[model samples]
Target: MARVELYVSADVEADGPIPGPYSMLSFGLAVCGTFDGTRFTAPDPSERTFYAELKPISGDFDPQALEVSGLDRERLLREGRDPAEAMRAAAAWVKTVADGALPVLVAYPLAYDWMWLYWYWVRFTSRSPFGHSRHLDIKTFYAARAGAMAARSTKRQMPAALLSARPHTHNALDDAVEQAELFQNLFRWGG
Candidate 1:
């Protein structure tokens, strides 16, 4: 099989989890280590891009999360694109970059990236844009490697010290970079 380059979808949420019936505040995304991109755009029709962002549906922002993402709510309201635009852009970007089969690796699989994205799409666009139903859950992958595997939830993650990992920006792009680094580290550690 051809080597499958990496792609990630990320989100920097406020306080609410999936079924957010709560809120998602802001989001940013980037694809790295393959296309040599400074932004999320895919350079070729066959290449792929990873995406992320924060979406505040209900207006409830988590103080800590807000502090972490550093996205200005007012700025988002004034400048941010609508959910439809974002999704369409994301799908178009992916069409340009993705070369894999299906079911890509996302940090938290169902909840964080996939579930939240699906929710946003179904709620706002009335359709789902994802090509697959599965995602590689990093937390569980790390845990299984560490013999402590559990279900995936944003609230959970492999202990940072386990991989001597440093802090993550929690910003969408930064977090995606960190997750890729963590996955690579796990691979090197024989996980």
Candidate 2:
């Protein structure tokens, strides 16, 4: 028998363009809901969530990227959680929340966040909770569902009804929760 697909919205704040040379300053995950093939059940996104800030793996960083997250690299070097411990904890959290269901990562655009998280997971934990390919790009989801060009399916272009009320605070956890609501709205949309 097929199990439910638990959608987890992910958001990452980084200090540079990519991982390794830079660092994923922080990241967050929020449980959006579940889909048992036919029905989508929306959940309270704030209830099941994970957040972590990690020490920089490399000293190199982009000033503009740092500006976006507003996380101090110097402070993080001193106070951030160890990457291995954090990623392992995050993986465990995903498993616990997923229970018997399959966890499918849901992210806006998908590529950027996935790149950082997947790299960190493999680097630090040897694997990822969402596996290698079970993920969804909300932008593409909207583009297909709305019958619009892929490039034209940006959040600014989405129906106002589909947008979440929460502000995009750039904090990974806040953005993750906000993204969860947007995912719920997009999943239940008919067209």
Candidate 3:
């Protein structure tokens, strides 16, 4: 029996910096690759994915953050899905795509995305599919694998081969897919 891990690239668009004080307006997940202890298989970014927009939990939000995402707070207030239902659906989707493999969340800088995701998972679904700590930070992973200083791990500093071809549009799903490509590239990169 070999250990299996599903690399899920997740991106979140939020109203503010923190979860409790603000809210995660939308999120997207794309299964980038899978590793079965020995080898990795990269998937098409559009293959298996999930996206959701949730109603705000709090009235307070940073105007600048909202601007970054280009999501209308007023529209979300009127049309967003319930957080609990959205989280449950997302968790179920993760499980379905993972198909018994351990699902590991992957993000550019896990700090910000993971914060909103983990908090929302617990607050809405009562548990996280990634089990609280199983996450990959792309920037950090690249820094460690490439022997670059942590502070200098920006995409511009990385090799051209490891960067995604897609643009970093603020749309959660688009960014998730873009990051999925990035994750595949980084996973295939050798020391």
Candidate 2 residues 134-160, lDDT tens each?
Answer: 999988899989999998999999999
Choose 1 or 2, whichever is better by TM-score: 2
Please name the candidate that would achieve the greatest TM-score relative to the true structure.
2
Choose the strongest candidate by lDDT: 2
The TM-scores, one per candidate, come to 0.66, 0.99, 0.98
Instruction: Give the alpha carbon lDDT tens digit for every residue of 1-191 in model 1.
Output: 43444445454455555545555555444443332223222222112334444345566655675676676776666666676677667655554545552324456443576666667667666755454453566666666677763753233455544442535666665565555555545544544
Which portions of model 1 show Cα errors greater than 4 Å? 1-9, 18-22, 29-55, 108-110, 126-129, 149-166
- Tens digit of lDDT per residue, candidate 3, span 45-69? 8789999999999999999998899
Question: Model 3 TM-score?
Answer: 0.98
Lowest lDDT block of 10, candidate 2:
182-191
Clashing pairs in 2: none
Scanning candidate 1 in windows of ten residues, the lowest lDDT window is 38-47
The lowest-lDDT stretch of 10 consecutive residues in candidate 3 is 182-191
| Candidate 3 Cα RMSD (Å) | 0.8
